[model samples]
Target: MIKLKAQDAGLSIAELTRRSVLLKPLPKRLSKITLATYRELVRIGSNINQLTRATNTAIKMGLRPPADPEQLEQLRNLLQQIGRELSQIETEITDDDDIESDGDSEDWE
Candidate 1:
């Protein structure tokens, strides 16, 4: 459990042990839904990369892609939406972090 918590906080086991002795608060993990959304984003990004590579290859070969224009526009819109979603998720996580920090660090110790 201590190792897991330390990993989540990007700390070494030694650092985590030191924090524990000092009663320092640990960083919180994202909620399950947030993690799931990130996973879905990665999956979608992989698909987009495949599509982009195919499109680029076709262009380089002087081949006109049948669904090129419309598909590219859709991908652009999707990328914008993904950016918005990421920003929203970041804001939510930042807010949560701020809430945790409202308490003084000395309180934890």
Candidate 2:
């Protein structure tokens, strides 16, 4: 199992790929999981780009960018939430072991 320290801070695509390989026991099932997650991430990235474009368009249209301080705070909170989720996912990928071990069995009385 790869020991991914918190300092690693999952961020870039290359880092994410490296982390995926670091996972312990490297199960075949994990390959599919990783691909699926990667696809979803791509979609999320696309959405973020669209959002940025829309925000810029709004600015160009002379619209104020979230005049409410609370709205700005909420946006910040949402971004932080997304960051945490991504980090957790990267950690999970790096730390996961595929092969299931035979856990200790208990004798029923």
Candidate 1 has which clashing residue pairs, if any?
Answer: none
Error of 1 at 101 (Å): 22
Clashes of each: 0, 0
Q: Compare the candidates by TM-score and give the number of the best one.
A: 1
**Candidate 2 lowest-lDDT run of ten:** 100-109
TM-score of 1: 0.55
Candidate 2 segments whose C-alpha is farther than 4 A from its true place? 1-30, 64-109
lDDT of 1 by residue, 10-109 (tens): 7898988888898887665554455666788778877777777777888888997544756866886887698688767765664334443433333221
Tell me how far the alpha carbon of residue 95 in candidate 2 is from the true structure, in angstroms, after superposition: 14
lDDT (C-alpha) at residue 63 in model 2: 88
Q: Rate the local accuracy (lDDT) of all candidates.
A: 0.67, 0.49
> Compared with the true structure, what per-residue lDDT tens digits does model 2 show for residues 1-109?
1233212333354554565577522221232355565677667666655666666677888887534445545655676576567556655652233234233232111
